[model samples]
Target chain A: MSTDTAPAPGAAPPASDERLREVSRVSRLLSRPELGAVVGAVLVWVFFAIVAYDNNFVSWATTAAIFNRAAPLGILAIAVALLMIGGEFDLSIGSIVGFAGMTIMVLSFPSDGGGFGWSLWPAILAALIVALAIGWFNGFLVITTKLPSFIITLATLFIFRGLTIALTRLRTNRTQLGNLDEVEGFALADTLFASQFEIFGARFRVAILWWIGLALVATWVLLRTRQGNWIFGAGGDANAARSVGVPVNKVKIALFMTTAFAGFLVALIQAVQFTGADTLRGFQQEFEAIIAVVVGGTLLTGGYGSAIGALFGALIFAMVQQGIIITGVDGDWFQVFVGTVLVVAVIFNNFVRQKAAQR
Target chain B: MSGNGTPLLEIQNVSKYFGSVIALEDVSAFVRAGEVTCLLGDNGAGKSTLIKVLSGVHKPTKGKYFFDGKEYNFSSPRDALELGIATVYQDLAMIPLMSVWRNFFLGSEPTKGWGPFRSYDSEFAKRTTKEEMAKMGIDIRDPDQTVGTLSGGERQSVAIARAVYFGAKVLILDEPTAALGVKQAGVVLKYILQARNRGIGVIFITHNPHHAYPVADHFVILRRGMVYGDYTKAELPLEQLVQMMAGGADLEVLQHELEQASREGGEEAEALAETAQAIESELDELEEKGND
Candidate 1:
């Protein structure tokens, strides 16, 4: 952007390192996409620590509780961030949770009561397949019609939510199911998805491991793989990616499936823990997951973000939601607090992107 | 490296129609290894349409495409790529948010090890990208810098260097200099020659004859979706190429319009009139030369 660097026309520029200084060290730090999310997570933690000083908010038990609450949302956030970076959306994820949970519950019910009483692992497998199919169909529709994923997935959200209720009611005459722990192989599913383990002198659900594992994998794929490159390319400029011979459609569709897979994981974890799921169990979670992603420093517009940032984004959400209770602040103001954080994060992310572009 | 004067990629009688809109009609051109073929055209002169056809983004509605003397029609961009034809689009097809190394090995990334552990070779990719960039006379201090941070000329050089690295026999650069400053445009033109020197067939497309004249070995002028003129560097001098680019005799009508507008009775208008007269005289000299 400066004149000294602009070599005179017709005079070939010699390959000299001293002639061009691209970015300063300080400016590079300021340009990181996840810087805002990390800073916000710290500030939110500090605020809770001071306000709830007299409460158990600082305890390892409460810490474990925060992890428990954040785990499911974190799983969803990582997947959502990937899809957002790949330049698509999945509004039907919350409904996928309900649908998958219902599939497991209905299939595993006792045979005498008009149920197949299928083994727990088989039911879970079937549910996963259904969820993946939904994801593939969502991606297929979005690609084939060239319509915005928001509209296509919004329509799917309603359609699948209705199916969950109608299909579950037809199976058991009730919109909710429970006592799936009685099925064969239930012990293994519960041990994997719902069991509590003592870590750092506090009991934590196994879902936390899943969340942490997913965050690490998503980070690895985003930073250390070719799929990550294609993801960014497809989101940044689809036509450009296509012209450059990138398989843009395959990347996007796979990302959609990834989001569905995350939703299924959360549903499986929750179902095994509670022994049940209602039709509206995962309702409004789509919005919460997106909020966590945005507050984690991901752009809703796509093509730029970090999965580790989403990890912090989910942490911030859990802290505010759980810490508000310990602080004795009106829990009703939780949304207000989260909403404010979201807007600020977006403004900051935009600023960082501009600063990075300028650098 | 096939510099035996054989066409590596050629298209004949290519016509593309998008539901009655004639984007390109009867456009024919060929490029040979170790030679720069310049396709000169104005906006909407089927330059982009022809590029899309060559790169296999769009199948020509009517025509024949040949690769190394073998008649073929490409159905996808990947097909063109497998045949060693790479196109560096005007926008460069780069993800600005991504790092330079990542953009360099975007679609065809080099990977290592077996399944699950099969990962993109970042150390190799970064080292290769930096080394290739340096070979292009661009000292990229950091291969990790986001491509958006690089100047237009540097970006164009990266695209060219990547093509050369991947062994593209026919490099189709679509308006690589259109978005750069004059200094940067000159820099990119140098890179075009650099690619050509690597025994690669270069198809350089531009609307500016000045940019085209210095680097192009052969010239094909396109106008209104058709081939207006085709000449070798030995046959087409710079002035004659400029004249042919401006649709002969059409320069007179534009000169008349400028003279009519110069009647606004101001010093700036007088300057405009003077410049217009210089252009008219240059056209006149080209006509006299054509007669000789």
Candidate 2:
């Protein structure tokens, strides 16, 4: 968009415009935002496949396990990726998870045993409503106060987490709520949230379906829709988007709410699977999701990322995390691996973008 | 185009105030279809403020604003845009990472299908982008290329072409040639004429009289929030336009003041004398260009 020289009219185009003509397949591949993540995922999977072959990491059961673990985080990462692309961060989702989970447990458990004893469906609905409200409030604060969402969501992270602790302890006299499987609609809730089905002799959780399904939908929305263009425009330059008649504030607020919904979904999945809820559930999951998003090729600075990229990021993260345990590597090396991969992925992303930009 | 037909845009006695700052006072300008109305002014001469008032970013404190001869009050830029007025700002409201087609059809993206299934009409967008750019006489090799890949002049041309494609009856360009090299400025100036030839009333805002002279059918010269002169091409020649754009007489007075101060003969006064000499040569150069 900026070069000192003007593009020569017709007789002889400048070298810069001429350079754009060399659109080789390699340059074509470099322009995709997900290229780095896809390449990194392939390398990581190959290295892991070779190293952990003896540990049965090659089996379908391991695939199911990896996906199950990756699903919850991946689902959140997809939504978080969208938010990041829209140019905001939600540190509140990690705490939103705890709050929503507690909301379900508190409302559904019998009051005789220090619970409201409400039906599971209502409790689930209520928690989702609260989650969206929290998301709205986070966006409202960020928008109205004109503070960076980093600060606003960070504040809500503690505020919501504290509310979960204070409210749960006030109602139950204990931070942890257990035996949620005993709730009235637990059977239905469990079926919907934690149902496992065998596919080729390996059990797969429904959450994996949610994650992949959401990833597809998000990818479509990001790449092929007008809203997608607005997202990029909003993140790339808010004032520019505003001048062009894009509803930037509304897009951002909706994105924040989407992350909260993601938190609620993850909370339901975990609560149903574990048969319990606690104030400290999903601690640091927000940061973990951000790491996944960044690794997925979504720019931390926003405007230049994709949900599919984020999904691959989560996949790589989950593979490495479970790979360490499966291969008998020290747990301490997990963070080291994650840290190194993140930096490498970002550098690779930048290198590819800059290279593409040169042409 | 102006006296024979109703002007496409007419602002009479427009005055704007930011708590008595008087950004624009008693300024009147008219833009006629198939005519280029160049708003030429130096810095702080209310060029931006007048564009803002016209585009509805700021309301005129007191004025009768007319579009196609109908008195109109625009509360927002969208209102003006919907009424066939489009402002192509200096920044051009473009996303550098997005493709040319994407940025070209940004706010008004074309979609296929309906509801959630509706998708960006990629084929139509790309074809239209290319066709539009071609119409402007700039051949785009690829619409998929990001706008950032284009040169500054090309980017400005894209914005102009986009507005034209979207049916902007009145095109407002803010400093279209201000930051461009000679060839680039000529590129933008050509587009301004192209837009006018298409019967779109173009308000080409700039401080450079040289860029505006050849293309402009009408000139609205502003100085200190008021119209210094408004003239037709025949009424104002290129030399006089350039002289008026700069404070031609005021430059002489400033030179005189510097000469008087240089009599102190300190090191700083010597620098002032040198600065005055530089101004004298610049004025002389302007005089030389004025003759031609």
Candidate 3:
């Protein structure tokens, strides 16, 4: 009889060079979930640049304008992307913008008509705290009740929106809060939120820098940190994540708070930039942010996405918005363009996902 | 192997009750280091309940659980993991879309920096994942490859290796080879042996007797939430193990009835007699082999 012992541990041969090369080729392409966003961004930019070339769409001023407009949306989109990657959503983010803006306005309006007349910095801080609390409440409700975040945040969206309108009407006797520019410390807040800078003879808002900084930090967190792994795990398969010792609930709660914090930042920027706040300041921003995130290559179902992709998505949005205006096309067509881009991007994302799973 | 020392893990008279329903009643098993304890049972045989009790998913209503010669109670799976007990569920707890290394170090990632600036040590993770998998005799072509691309057997190997690498003193595998084909099941069986060789107390739960008989040092047959029989490999032969797993006395009585019916002499009875005779000869051969 032949004596055949089990193969020794670690006895398998190493992968051949040919196999390595084949694997690397597939992995290299599949590694970047943001590739679709990059291609979409380039295609949109080229299309806009070519279509609106005669209208100075490619000029530095127009480019700066696109960046300026994209900043707040990009900031919110980054947070939305993070939340989505952690397998959650914050539909109340739009309501938070309006609520935070109104908070800053009413507290720092410097008017006798039911206003607190506080300094701008204190008002901003108070608004930020309120936003954080709302986020905490949303997270707690979703976690403790074990309900879908989509439904939970959808309810909060209407609740907060109503609260914003009621508070604005009760305080100002109108749907708007004004006199923000006359508040003490308005200039200080403006210097950080609404300040303008000239680069290559083009003016750009300070919000652009904040957007870039936030994106860089988010990208780092997504790719380089333990928390990033938890986010991916929680989104990909929460039960599995918990089985492996990931604090899935904690990661999700933090993501919700982060999204609210992002909403507060956008509200502060807009309040300072416009010198006032309207009850409808952030109308539909939640949907828009989700759209941008989806366009950036984050899955609607969660667990796969990139912050850099969201940034590009925001840029594409801003380009289409401003490009249409510059090209003298009907502004209503902007929504049509967004709808088309979303569908096309989703199809492209599916194609890329299938390719990545090809093995 | 078991009597040489105290078992690495021992569950004594464990009983679990789900409200009014009795899921498991007075089950007992012990796993020794460097031995494979095969828990054999078919579906609805309280195998899952026993596994849950061992893995700390449920606190036994009555019974003492001892580990490393000390009695303790586990409040959660996390607590069990902290105490060096890792359970690889049938699902494997792996994210399919994630890379093999990422799945390998899902929750317990290695970090490389200080305080707030800390980052995932990707290099260490990839290298360790490769080395650990190789220890289980799996040569992964790329650590960056997603876990979904691996075959079912390879995925099970990855989970097993991950448990061992993470310092599991006792490894509980839940139907790991249930979905695999013959070749794949053999591959997983080999890995179980590998784990056992490393002195890990392996509690392998499966309904397949063929898979268990070859690798098991001790077999504990579970039937309807109670222990039917427990025997060491030397004391109990493979044929008896199969018979016990298939319900020993009941199956024999059924065979005798079939033989009696065949003696009545009809076409159907003749066919039944042929089948009964075939089964008897197979058992005879198995008994002869056992006697040898």
Indicate which candidate wins on DockQ. 3
Cα lDDT of model 3 by residue, B10-39, tens digit: 999989999998888888899999888999
Candidate 1 chain B lowest-lDDT run of ten: B283-292
TM-score of chain B of 3: 0.85
Compared with the true structure, what per-residue lDDT tens digits does model 1 show for residues A82-174? 999888999999999999988888899886765678989999999999999999999999999999999999999999999999988877788
RMSD of each: 6.4, 6.8, 6.6
Model 3's chain A TM-score stands at 0.93
- lDDT string, candidate 3, A1-359, tens digits: 11112233564454464566555654676657787888888898899889999999889999998999899999999999999988898999999999999999888875677778888889999999999999989999999999999999999999999999998888878887766788888888889999999999999999999999999999999878889988998988898889999998889889999999999999999999999989998899998899889988898887889999899989888988989989999988889989999999989988887877774
lDDT by candidate, in order shown: 0.84, 0.87, 0.87
- How many pairs of residues collide in each model? 0, 2, 0
Which residue pairs show collisions in model 3? none
Evaluated against the true structure, the overall lDDT of model 2 is: 0.87
Q: Against the true chain A, what TM-score does chain A of candidate 1 give? A: 0.92
Q: lDDT per residue, candidate 2, A246-328, as tens digits?
A: 99999999999999999999999999999989899989999889989988888877788999988998998898988898999
